[model samples]
Target chain A: MAAVVEASRGERDNQDQELVQRALTRDPAAVAALVRRMAPVVHVRVARALSRRRVEARGRDLRADMEDMVQEVFAALFESDGRALRAWHPERGLSLENFVGLLAEREVVSILRSGRRNPWTEDPTLDTTLNELDTDQQSSAEGRVASRQRLDQLMDRLRERLSPLGLHYFRLLFVEERGVAEVAEETSSTTDALYAWRSRLGRLVKQLARELDDEEEVSDE
Target chain B: MSEDLPIRVAQRLREEDEALDPRLERLAMGALSPEALAELEADAARDPELARQVALFRPLSSELQDRLTEQMSAPVAKVIRPARWTRWGLPIVTLAAAALLLMTLRGPSALPSYAGRVEGGDVVLRGEPTPAAQGRRVMRGDSLLTLELSPATQVDGAVVARAYVRTPAGARAAPGVPEVDPSGAVRLRGVARELLGVASGTVSVALVVARPGALPEPDAAFAPSEGPRLEVQLLLR
Candidate 1:
């Protein structure tokens, strides 16, 4: 089974690399294909970006605005010999979809910020250090690996504190990443109740994080 | 401290622990201070468990984003209709309606009555409360002689008794402390203009007793039936 999965992954990587090369060469069909595949995800990401900033579309045509943002993302990806597309190293074993989604999200957020009538004047969701971590350029790969290990240990401790309901909530919300409405309908609960549960779960995780941090500082001293 | 978080988030968490929403929101938006994000990254880098937590919560940021996006994308139906009434016209129409209602409420025959015995000469309908007997000219707003009864009726095994008056308008309980003395006395004073109307009519006064296991509705007693009763004759010319 493992070998089959590995073989499939290899085939997908080859396909992705070929598409990327074709797109970089400015093949019209290749570019169109990429756009078709990326548009929905890009539109979703852009909408998410603006919302996190609390940018109100107000009475404006939001669909048009989203289309405009998606266009801009495509334009950037294909500009100047498709530098961004070439820069993406699928050999790094990262999901190419996630990389493109993140790129599109960042580009959309930048466009929204620079928009002439942009409602948001601040980057409310910007965490520059995490942003730096995302690039993985500011820290050694080994350091990131070690940090991830420490994070796992802390999570195990938190898991112990969570009740069955809490665990179920985390699984549904985070692990499954299902929509709140969908989850609420499935569980026979109100969306408001689901939001409340999520808020509570977040607090529990943050509290546990704080306690873990305190213990680490004590040990370091 | 809870106030620092979004109202929805604070609604579900303890005051001390309610900042998670803003923290996560800021984290997702990349809005946290460089120092704080760096510290968080360092912590995650050093702790594998924390890294897993970070991984778990990474999707939550997107979940929130998707939720907000979905909300924004929902189509809002705007209904545009022609104005039914002008701004000034609305108030005038309202005032006229209110005036008509007031007239209907305060017109003659809006008076209420109470249950009591009507002796032959007890109720006198004149222009005012007077010693006039039997028949008298009654107009709108004229007071009638008070109704007085003596041993109007007796019921067996009646634990409680309630008296109500039936008028042309409606039936209402007599306005006084319920007193069924050993002599069984109930009296009521009313105006003919209010109870009988300006157009000369008769009103019926009835008493109902609630027997054990058979409690009579006070309003139901006002309906003429087989029960303790007194017939009062009022001739308003």
Candidate 2:
């Protein structure tokens, strides 16, 4: 089993190297292959993050968003100067799983951070409105109730690790729903920094969302 | 050079991972160091998928860690208390709350209590909203029970969570998760996850409604999720 696993890793590395070359050559097939190879990893990570989302849906609508996040990452990664990925180093002990995991985390975090939220609350307005809707009703379905709870948990987790500055940044950028120019003016930071932090924090949130989801899953077990 | 931060983040992640539930333990790019974490993380690290996941998360300062502990609590967000109140809340309380987190109760679960039974079909939310009306009908498959909007309304996916006051006017829809404006009419926002899907099976949303009055009744102000909400209405149908 160990030998088989090792062989598979080796084989995969070879494939990746070839794919990188072809991608760099602007081969669309390589890009497609890269997505096919990596999409599931991102999906799994994203689903896990969204699971942390904690909102119960009659239908799993967020699944669509999760899939989009992963797909976007693959598209970006493969759209290089030559469609070849410059970031990967397969031989130095980088695993595709980790590579994709990192990407998903960053993506998920950015998605969460980008949403304009309620600054005083640190909760996104959209999400908050949804929760309020759930609570106001006279009777609710068990499933919907569960979804609401999960949403709450996911939000709590997002706010959990935020620093004062980070929180302030998030408030200005997301909660306060400020523009990049506005955020820069308020923080005395450049627009680039604000953009970069949003991305960074977004990645962090995505990671946390996945973790929160896993936490939910683990608890189920 | 930039990668070193991931290393520190990974170390902290490993620490966090040890305490995390299994599925969440190793999803980021940097996580439990195979060597540094508890036995569980060490074992999880051996898997390339998990290890790769550890690397994906963002790294922040320790200040965030301390803040996380505080942020996870609703009581903290709601108010600041003295040491005595804080002591009562307890870290253990929050830790224990992991089990209790994400308990969203939408619709009739909002009210304190009352009961009826449905003989056939199931309750469902159908139709659109009006100034006087919010959502309509309740269904479980072909069988349907129409629902008239009340106050304090909440919706989870399809399930409704709400509470009722004395008069029909007082009774409202479920509590919206994040809280909504009632100036016009009933509107909903998704919030807090209630039940979770176990990896093996589909986690479903089941709806219920209770029209309980009086705060002191046996059915009054329950967990908001304890009873079969649609049962009474179902019985009526």
Pick the lDDT winner.
1
Candidate of highest DockQ: 2
Candidate 1 regions exceeding 4 Å error are: A1-7, A51-55, A115-221, B1-237
State what share of the real interface contacts each candidate retains: 0.00, 0.00
Question: Candidate 1 overall Cα lDDT vs. reference?
Answer: 0.45
Compose the digit string of candidate 2's lDDT tens values, residues A1-221. 00001113445466567655654544433333344334445655565665444332223345344434554444444443422256655654445555555555555655555544211124344446566676776455645655444444444455446533564565455544579887787556788988998788667756765786787689899
Number of backbone-clashing residue pairs for each candidate, in the order shown? 29, 157
How is the predicted docking of candidate 1 categorized under the CAPRI scheme? incorrect
TM-score of each: 0.27, 0.28
Please report, as a value between 0 and 1, the fraction of native contacts recovered by candidate 1: 0.00
Where is the poorest 10-residue window by lDDT in model 1 chain B?
B78-87
Q: In model 2, state the lDDT of residue A57.
A: 27
lDDT per residue as tens, model 1, A140-164? 7646644543444334444456533
- Candidate 2 TM-score restricted to chain A: 0.46
